[model samples]
Target: MAEGAFIRDVASFEGREVEIRGWVYNSRSSGRIHFLILRDGTGFMQAVAVQGQLPDRAFQAAGFAPQEAAVVARGLVRADRRAPGGYELELRDLEVLQGSPGYPLTLKEHGVEFLMDHRHLWIRSPRQHALLRVRAELIAACRDFLDSDGFTLVDAPILTPAAAEGTTTLFEIRYFDRSAYLTQSGQLYNEAAAMAFGKVYCYGPTFRAEKSKTRRHLIEFWMIEPEMAYCDLEQCLEVEERMVSAVVARVVERRRPELAVLGRDVSKLEKIRPPFPRISYDEAVEMLQRAGHSIKWGDDFGAPDESYISQQFDLPVFVLRYPAACKAFYMQPDPARPEVVLGADLLAPEGYGEIIGGGQRIHDLELLQARIREHGLNEANYGWYLDLRRYGSVPHSGFGLGIERTLAWMAGLEHIREAIPFPRLLHRIYP
Candidate 1:
């Protein structure tokens, strides 16, 4: 137990003696020789203790009955190609710290319900560990992209008095004297900040009370949104492409090992580079109809339609300028065709639909007020928002990127639950 020695540092102590105190992952005894795989939170190491060659105390301590028993070992590190990590340890001393009884998750199959119930322990598994590592990389890549692009990171209020989008999916929480809802999107507040900072973004968790049972929906999820002042929908799409491309590039560069663990082909991610193909809502409807999908214009694309349209392109494709009636109240109407909104959805390839939803917002106070009234929303609730337009408003656009969905696609996970450590689904929310 040297002052500066960690379990991972054992590789540097190769061919020399060292001590690693950790829990046993598993152990196999073959009468004459014992092999124990130990993990100390930093890395895993294999320890070998031979009978008649070591003291009786060492052999007894290494003879773990159950897999997860805790023990400390003093051994000599040696390089061996037969070992998984190319390093092996010959034990000199052993101490049992804690004795573990029968474990639930063994080297066998379990039902999805059982696994979800034990998600607290399931994250320690190799697959989840690899998935979380990739998630960390994705978050870092997002921050890196926003920071490098001159976008200031601004945190929005979680508890709000009124809904910015609508009251349909609001998660109401009892406040001191009134009811408050979790912020669904930070776009409205980010728009106010954009007037001051020119470009601003918010990255945090959003909540919805709707009972959705789809692979693409989460009751609570993280969103990364960027708002640009004086920028139109075209400029917003350009930034979106660059930001997403930068994130994909970082994952490719840093998480090659993690991706390999999840059995993902890195080339699928490498195709996420610049100039993602763009198509209009009208074109998408036509393509879907041609592809045997019966989706007509003026209808929001469903999951099946999204998958069909996304399948046509190798990388993520942008479906822009949807019918204005289907969009949120904040979307700006197309000047040429007032029936279409200046919005876009970035649909990921491989059937990962709608990772990003964003568009230009109405800058004129009159138009915003008219849209609000037409949508049957209370004008009093949005008085402060309309003030942004009354004072000095410029064309601004932004988008929200769902973190869990993006991570699921990036990690090639079969389900979105695998991406989140503790998922809050419609039917279950525990541990």
Candidate 2:
């Protein structure tokens, strides 16, 4: 019986015979000599076989078919500088475990729709592997940063009785004769946990039923929500900058090989550090207007406006104190300018817009109630939430960062869809 080993572990088995099980990523034949590239999840390695050197059946099997065909190859590991991993397997035996029938995804270029339609197979590609590797590192970086800062990991509910933010974007379903909606953000729930834990965060999937199809929007995406019990908007922005910088630094440090594979410019990522540029909403609008943009004062900045503003700074631009009319009912109004809310949008460099949206929540019961009424929202739906304010609620602030959007920015990917494995978009939803 052959001892199963991973393709990445083949290096440790140099000059020793080992059995590697994997799907054939690609293969080539040269009359008497054959080369098979195997991918076993961890990584890939090449296996070389000679026609006369192996059994007749093995040689016949080596001449076989398409990419990603499952197979097990028994071979002796040998070091070669020319090979991908500085090593190659000299195949002594080969057998197909399972064969794929005319795989559609080839090494050649594929259309975006075609690739997305075949996402199950697309993840096996070098680019997708690189993106996923970066995603893992980014996630780990986020968790590590929060953990180091004395933040507890608290998981909130995915199915809830009522919507936390707004109902329009929620995906509701019937739950035991009552109505339930998939959570859009865990901020409100995490706020309750924060009162107990002081500082806590929730990282998980959040759903939104957005009807538009944009490069930055996703029907289902992961969000990282960090809530602090006694934090204000300024402190919140500080934590946000530090967390983002830590994630970028860790990704650059640990995933250099993967970044190189993706052809990302690491220098840009290396420049990400603390003290990101900050501007008030009024100032940002002024700057936009100075730059010949026709952006009005109160409206939420569109994609192009965000891109233009972000282009002015090397790091993310923290746009703060947006108009109260445009912000959510929960955001606290700026004391100096009563018309503006103490909310912010963290815009990533190079046109990646609004990776983080957060604010100082209205912790006062009367103010919250008034805002809810002012916004024409159903105050009855938020009775329990209002109770938090009535009973010892302290000043709090938090933010929700869409994981796929952040990953897309960090991985230097063109489309946000490429950052997630099984992306759910408006027009496309399938395997």
TM per candidate: 0.95, 0.96
TM-score of 1: 0.95
lDDT of 2 by residue, 164-218 (tens): 8764589989999989999988888888888889899999999889796888888
lDDT of 1 by residue, 1-431 (tens): 42224566777888787778777877888877889988776667788988765689878767754677777778788888877688988887777877777877775888899999999877766677778989989999999899988999998888998988884589889999899999998888999999989999999989888988988888888999999999999999999999989998998899887898899988999888889999999999999999888788899898999988888888899999999888999999999999999999999989888899999999999999999999899999998899999888999999999989999888887889887779998998988
Q: Which candidate gets the maximum TM-score versus the true structure?
A: 2
Full-model lDDT for every candidate: 0.87, 0.88
Q: The CA-based lDDT of model 1 is what?
A: 0.87
Runs of candidate 2 exceeding 4 Å displacement: 1-3
The true-versus-predicted C-alpha distance at residue 116 of model 1, in Å, is: 0.5
Give the CA lDDT, 0 to 100, for residue 143 in model 1: 91
Give the count of colliding residue pairs in each prediction.
0, 0
